[model samples]
Target: MTLVLFNKPFGVLSQFTDRGSPTTRATLSDHIDLPGVYPAGRLDRDSEGLLLLTDDGRLQAQIADPRFKLAKTYLVQVEGVPDDAALARLRAGVTLNDGPTRPAEVERIADPALWPRDPPIRVRAHIPDCWLSLTIREGRNRQVRRMTAAVGHPTLRLVRWRIGDWTLADLPPGQHRIIG
Candidate 1:
């Protein structure tokens, strides 16, 4: 079975099917040459970073299933500097509409060297910004964004950095590489 590590670019859908859109453009199918492989997990169409695809159902399940405790890390840029208390709240688990999420590993990180998004994030003159490295074991719908919003610092930009043992590393946006 073929296994791939893809650095999904912004504005690209996670699935091969476009669902009948007028602008039928890029997708995982456009970049990944491997056949019979599907995304192990999904990154939002607006977010960019490490995505795993595999033909092996067992491997895909191992990575995507919350029971495996695979960690997914994201570098999030928020509208304001998050205080220690807010960080603590993130680490202690915040209640979302779904329920309280498992406590995440949250810490401030240096701004990574990143390619500019196709449509850049809006910048406000007065509001300060900060970046955080957040690691969560569970895959929840828009969990990171919801967590930040719950803490009063709305996320302006979000980029996934790592999933399990894989990372963004040297892969640029719209790039992909096959790995064990």
Candidate 2:
């Protein structure tokens, strides 16, 4: 079984097949060429980084299943600088429209070391944005983006830096490497 780690760039879909829809955009075919491998987990088309792909079904499930409790860490840039109280709310579970999320390991951090996005995030001089290192074991749909928004700081950019024992490390955007 071959396992690969890829830095999923922003605006790339996680699937291999394109269904010929106008908004379906670009699929994994546009980047990766590994024939039998499938994505172990999903990152929304707008989000980026640290995606795992594997030919083994068991390995894919092991990484994607929440029961594994594999921590996924994201470098999130939000609309405003969050205070301690707001950060605490993030550390404690914040209530989203769907339900309450599990408490995250959250902390303020300096702007991440990253390659610039193709269509860079819009900047507002007066907004005073900030970056955070937020880690969670759950893989809810768009959870990171929703979490920051629930805390009154909408996320401007979200990049997954690590997933379980895997990390982006030295991989630049659109890069991939074989693991095992």
Candidate 3:
């Protein structure tokens, strides 16, 4: 059995191959060389951090399947300092275009010490931004970004700090490590 934790960098595709792109894009293939291993879940091209990979199908399903409800934690930087009401709404679950989300474990967090993102997130001089530590069991496309947007604070940067029992701890961007 093989379990790999990858620190996916910004602008990097979650898949090993960038099959349909009109131009070349960085992918897991650029970083990971282990044969027969596939990403357990996807991290958006614009997002960064912990992306699990596995050669075992059952293990991959356990990590990636929403039915398993594995908690995925993100350190999010948002455009505005969310008010108590906004935080409450996020904790209680907000209605998105697709549907209402399950309640998430969320709190305003101090800005984490992280490697700088390539090209960096935009900074607005007039509008102050803040960080949040949020954990969700469901994997929806851009769910964290959408959920924060629903509360009027758009996400500027998102990093998956942990997924299930694995973490991005000590893993720098564009690096991968394999464990049994």
Candidate 4:
């Protein structure tokens, strides 16, 4: 079984191919050349970090299926410093338009030493921003972004640092390493 860990860069599609898109975007094919391996889960095009791909279908199912409840951790940079109440809401669970999200492990964290994003997040001279380490078991469509926005602190940047036991570590963006 071939298990590959890819550090997906911002603006790169989770899929291997880019077909019928309105604008040109980078796809997984640009980073991963290993044939037959498919992505186990998806990372949004606008988000960056660890994406696991494998040739084994059972392993892929284990990783992606919500029933397995693999914890996904994200390093989120938000527009403003979130107060205790806002953090409490995230910990308890927030109601989104789709539905109420499962309770998440959320905490304020120091800015992680990460690689610089290509375009960079928008900055305001007066407004204060902060970093948060959030872990959620379920992967919904832009769940992290929505959760932060719901609490009044819009996510400025999102990075998936770990999925289950797998982590990005020092892997630079757009690079893939075969672990097993």
Candidate 5:
């Protein structure tokens, strides 16, 4: 089975092809040339970082299926410093419009040393921003963003730092390497 680890840049689609969009956007094909490999899970167009691709259907299922509960970790930058209550809510799991989320491992973290985003996130001089290392066992659409928003600190930037054992270490934006 072929497995590719890609550091997806912001504004890029998780899929290989961009279809029917009014304007052209970067897709996986722009970084990956390996045929038959597909994304195991999606990273939003606005989010950046580690994304896994594999040729094996079984492997894809293992990585993406919430039933398996493979932990996915993210480095999130929120609009304000999350208080003890907000952090506790995240660790205990908060309810989203879709439904309740699985409890996540959450903690405030110093700003991570990472590649500069192409179009940087917005800056607010009046309000403070902070980062968090959040790990969740379930994949819900925009779950991290929604959770933070629910806690009153809207997400400013989101980066998938690790998925199970795989991480983005040493991989630059818009680059991919076959791991297996």
Candidate 6:
């Protein structure tokens, strides 16, 4: 099996092509040139971090399918510091438009040692922001963003730090390494 670990940068689409877009946008083809490899899962265009690509279909299923219950960890920067009550709500799972999310392992964390994001996250002199480390086994559409917003701490930035045993490690943004 051929596995590629890519540190996807912000504003880059998860797919290899941006087929019907009115305007040009960054896509995986800009980073990956390998044939047959496809992203095992997805990260939003605005979110940054570890993205797994593989040529094997079964491996892709194992990584992306929620039925497998592989844990995905994220380092999230939210608009405001979350109190214990907010963190508790996140840990217990909060109801969203789609439905209630599965319980997540959530904790307050210091700002991670990370590469500076280009066009850095907006700053507000009055409203303080904080970071959180969150791990969830389910991947829903914009679930992390929704979860944080649901608890009154909208995410200012989101980074997928790990998926199962795979991690971004020291790989810089917009870079890829062959892992298998």
Better of 5 and 6 by lDDT: 6
- Per-residue lDDT of 1-180 in model 4, one digit per residue for the tens? 999999999999999888998988899998889999999999999999999999999999999998999999999999999999999999999999999999999999998999999999888999999999999999989999999999999999999999999999989999999999
Instruction: Tell me the spans in candidate 1 whose CA falls farther than 4 Å from its real position.
Output: none
lDDT per residue for candidate 1 within 1-180, as digits (tens), equals 887888898888899889889988678887877778999988898888889999999999999998998999999999899999999999999999999989999998778678888899999999989999999999888889999999999998889989988888999888888885
Q: Encode model 5's per-residue lDDT on 8-53: one tens digit a residue.
A: 9999999989989999999998888998999999999999999999
Clashes of each: 0, 0, 0, 0, 0, 0
Instruction: Give the distance in Å from residue 56's predicted Cα in candidate 2 to where it truly belongs.
Output: 1.2
Clash number for candidate 3: 0
User: Which pairs of residues clash in candidate 3, taking residues 3 or more apart in a chain or in different chains?
Assistant: none
Better of 1 and 6 by TM-score: 6
lDDT of 6 by residue, 1-180 (tens): 899999999999999999999999999999999998999999999999999999999999999999999999999999989999999999999999999999999999988999999869999999999999999999999999999999999999999999999999999999999989
Worst 10 residues of 4 by lDDT: 16-25
Candidate 5 has its poorest 10 consecutive residues by lDDT at 26-35
Better of 1 and 6 by lDDT: 6
Sorted by lDDT (best first), the order is 6, 4, 5, 3, 2, 1
lDDT by residue (47-125, candidate 2, tens digit) is 9999999999999999999888889999999999999999999999899888898899999998777899989999998
Error of 4 at 159 (Å): 0.5
Q: Could you tell which candidate, 2 or 6, scores higher by lDDT?
A: 6
| TM-score of every candidate relative to the true structure | 0.96, 0.96, 0.98, 0.98, 0.99, 0.99
Candidate no. 4 TM-score:
0.98
Off by over 4 Å in 4: none
Model 5: per-residue Cα lDDT at residue 19 = 89
Per-candidate Cα lDDT values, in order, are: 0.90, 0.92, 0.94, 0.95, 0.95, 0.96
